[model samples]
Target chain A: MSRVLSSKVALGGWIISSLALAAVVVLAWASPAWAGTTTPVLRLAAEVAPHDPGAVELLATLEQPREPVSSGRVSLGGVSVSFSVRVEEFSGAPLLALGTAKTDAAGIAMLTYRPTWTGRQAFVATATNEAGTSLGSATTTFIAKSSPQSFAGTVEAVRPDGAIGQAVAGVLLSIVALIWIVLLAVVVRVNLGLGPSRAAESSGLKS
Target chain B: MSKENPSIAEDHACDLGEEVTEPGELADVRASAMRPVLETPRWWWPAVLVLGAIVVLGIVAWVVQVADGLGVAGYNDRAFWSIYEADLVAFIGVSYGGAVVSAILRITKAAWRAPLTRIAEATALVTLPVGMLFIVPHLGSPWKIWELVWPPYWNLSSPILWDFFAVSTYLLATAVFFYLPLIPDLKIAQEWLDPNRPGLRSRACRRIYKALGGNWTGSAPQRRLLHGAIGLVAIMIIPMAVSVHSVLSFAFASSSRAGYLETIFPVYFVVAALYTGVALVVLSIAACRRLWHLEAFIHSRHFVRLGFVMVAFGAVYLYLTFTEYLIDGYSGTSGNAAWVHQVLLGRYWIPFWFYFVAAGVVPIVIMAFRRTRTARGAVVASGLVVFAMWVKRLVIVIPPATEPLVRSPLSAGGVLAGNWGTYHFTWVPISITVAATAAIPLLLLVLFRFVPILPIAEMEELAGPEERAESVAVPGLSSGDGFRPAAALGGRSLAASTSPPSAMGEEGGR
Candidate 1:
């Protein structure tokens, strides 16, 4: 009776230990996916502020909600952020790359963009890790009232007046005209027998 | 000038003694000059047909290009201007030789120029138009060429506009220059024709000649007027031709591209034109001499003299090329240095060395030695020079055009290491270029059928008392029944008599 009891205890302990080992193996295999699912989601926010006459300052904040914070702010430094702008309101309109900025210690990225035309402009800021994986993105809108006057005026001023070019062209045209006249006059003279006659001279002045 | 007169060979045996007059000698000149016009050789028709067929193929290719697009010609955004531009510069550049030979020689009163002048001037007359027509193929929409001349579409700042004005003016001057000399020869050609030949071709030829030369009587006053007019036109043409090539260079130099932006391009292009121009003249003279049996008139001395001229210009062009490369390379600006590298050591090295060997070194070598300084040597050197110069123009045009002016953000390298574009020539451009080349000889052959191959009156005038006196004492130059030897003519040799002994002595023996 004692031997049978000891054997039953051994068999029970072997089965229980095997079950524990299998459980440990399964857990080890699934831990990474579970950890990935539990990772903190990144969030982004974008804001625009008028800086200069034709330029506006863009600020984008990137934050991980579950990350440890210092002084009540999420510090997401060294992450690259790209800024884009779309003047068209349609859904399929392409986003033009405005510029790129990097997040600072305060988890905020800043860029200065000069608006070319007066309209409602939609801005997008995207955050990406070193491997170029997009972490998160944000969108914002701003209405520009008066188009920059100096920009238009400056472009117009930079255009050539063509004064000297026209003068040179005029002179060349005049010279070409003079050459044509001289050539034509000579041709006419040759046709009209207006020159001295070598034949008459050779004929002993016999007309 | 009668057709019943003995063949040039038989006529050579007759002894006029010391009493041979100018009229008798001039009659021989006229007979020899008009032979090609009066008699059609067996080879003439077949050659014309072949050349014409090639030209037709070029036209078909052009049509296909117009129907499709410039893509057929391997044109793209990167290689927008390539072969046709080179062709334009080259063809136009070759015409300068004719002007230099005819006009400059006329003004300088080089009497030896008489036999070659007609060939030279006719060459200019035909080639300038052909060169101008290259603009058609160069343009993406050739039909829009009218905009170039139309006033409202004119861009005053554009070098192309000035190029048009300059080239057109030069063309008019070329036509006038060609026509003024032909008046005297036209009279001779008309006198040679049978007044009552039954065929329409004969009648038409007579009528055309009559209309062109009816007013020309070769009177003293007419000669004076013609001479004065020719002199004035000759003087005008030199500057006009210079301006045409200068404006052509300006078309490149005005651009901000690396290889093209040099201030030296104008002088460089002008010298290249003169060099290649003389080469074409040599080739023309050689062809005429060989094909028409003008060996008696056009001699080895003429070739050697023209070869000397070619080498002088070649030396200048080579110097300019060296300086252009050195300055651009030494400065080491990204664009300029990259272009220089591309030409000298990179993708274009083959053509660059080809130019260096053919145009730069070989011709100089040919001109340097007495043994190789024959008509044959001149022709060989000229063929090489013409071909090589065309390649050099390509080197000048393509490298700068294919170079990447702006750097790409995606690329790791800067502008210096930027990707260079290539112009791959398809059959369209090659056919057109070959056809244009063939048109040169084809047109010359056909042209000489209507006009005298030699300037008969000019040769007569140039054969003065000293020449007439020498011609009588010299044995008949003909050996057997064919072309005569250059040496037998002795002091009567037109080139030997006129050219400085220093220049003609080495080649005069032949």
Candidate 2:
């Protein structure tokens, strides 16, 4: 009976140690220091104007993996050239898209983004190769608060401006329409000419 | 007054030399031209099967590429415009060559073009569709190709949209150009089809000929109307061909890249197309002469004439290349200098030098030497010109595209793999290109099986005075001042000689 109790005590001790080890691991993962240094992270920055709130600027930098408690900056240059990055609301509705921006030598991309809503937002950057194969992706979050501005200016800026641009567009379309019309006329004329029995019966050749 | 087999007709005419003036001889000439079309050769089936297989393989490869994206075809954003783009240009350029040469000959009233006109126009007809289809593979989303023609979605400023417009219109014009000339020949082919042999294939062939021919009764009014229409279309085709290659050049020249930012690119592209087009024509003539036993028709003199034209265009292209380089290279803008250096002295040196030597120098030498001005020599010269021009197009496209725009340092992976990256061709594109190469001969071989290899009507029109004497003697012929009524060289034909017995008897009755 004494030997059995001793064996039971040993089994209880093993269980207690395993539980303690798991708890320690969970604590380490949850800690800020461990979370910051454990994996490569994405750094996001927003440059917003107080008065002209529509012109919101978004910047994304892909950070490299690091050791815990280190304050040194990691090199992210050449990691993302012509990479796609997006700014969206926390609920996943996109507010701005910087379509395929040119990355600086230092691996930072300055994107021109106009935010629609004012609240917590997320920036997601995706890297891809020339073959359109995705390499890696990262995301970061930020908050946005802007002064009231009408959406009219944004709409105006999006459209082609000036009479010259409009005139060029008009002329090009007209030419295309004319070309199609002329081609159709040629077809109809050829088909009409090919009508049966148009040639003289005496010759027996109907050309 | 009796009809003789066409096989011996031409030989008898050539042997008799201005003596075979009987009306039955005309029927004989038509029969000779249609012999290859009517009689199937033992080798034809196997050839078709082989070419068909190659075409099928290419189709399968294209399907695979579409499903997996252009990445499966070795297309990266860095190498966005590569082999297929060059192929498109080359194929389209050759078609332009065929159309322009035939048109110019017709316009100039070069009578020797009789045997060649049909083949040249048919080349344009077959190739335009092939060239146009390359755009599908070139696009990232090929299924969205309808967006090009759909009016509302058209991008007015896009070079590609204009390319679509020019090519589609050009295709329509080419088809009409090809078809209008074919009407007379089709009528003649219908006459040759033996009603006794009522096989499915023969019946189908006869029906097609009649349908295409329409009501072409070789009467004076019909001939005049047809000639007028063809003349008008011929005048229009030249400008259309010019516009096609010019717009194609704009796609490159509009870009700010070093080699592409030249003012002379439009003319350069057009001249190159002309040079290569004429050379390909010479090559096609040689192939036809051997394959269809057209030695009696397309003689050594024809090759020499075509070679002269090819050489003329080659000379101009060489001059343009020099001028294009001298101005740009002298200015020494960093981009221009870098691109020029890359092509001339860097990685692309071999192809550049090959274009200069083979397309330029060798052809000039061949044309200069009287002994090497034979048909065989011309064929060799054309072969070199065609190959070298294709390489020249690659040199034109690749160097400007790959020249560094931003000059970022090398990375482990991504578009910025180096300070400037090169377009590396993989197996996928190579296979697809090979398949395209095989398609040309395959298409031509199959096309000629249905129609006479030579244009029967044009041949009769251009035949010697001896052969045309019988044709002119028919009743109700309204011969104008420019038109000859009979083989008589003088203003008026002798009344007795004008009434050939064969013209009044058997053929007139039919």
Per-candidate TM equals: 0.70, 0.68
Question: Once model 2 is optimally superposed onto the true structure by TM-score, how far is the C-alpha of residue B142 displaced, in angstroms?
Answer: 1.4
Docking quality class, candidate 2:
incorrect
Least accurate 10 contiguous residues by lDDT in model 1 chain B = B500-509
lDDT of 1 at B457: 63
Off by over 4 Å in 2: A1-197, A201-207, B1-29, B407-418, B464-510
How accurate locally is residue B326 in candidate 2, as Cα lDDT from 0 to 100? 88
Interface RMSD of each: 12.5, 12.2
Q: Write the per-residue lDDT of candidate 1 for residues A92-142, one digit (tens) a residue.
A: 566889999988876788888766644456888888877787777778886
* Per-residue lDDT over B244-308 for candidate 2, one digit per residue giving the tens place of the 0 to 100 score: 99999999988888889889999999999889988888887777656655554555556777899
Looking at model 2 chain B, which ten-residue stretch has the lowest summed lDDT?
Answer: B496-505
How far out, in Å, is residue B408 in model 2?
Answer: 8.0
DockQ of 2: 0.10
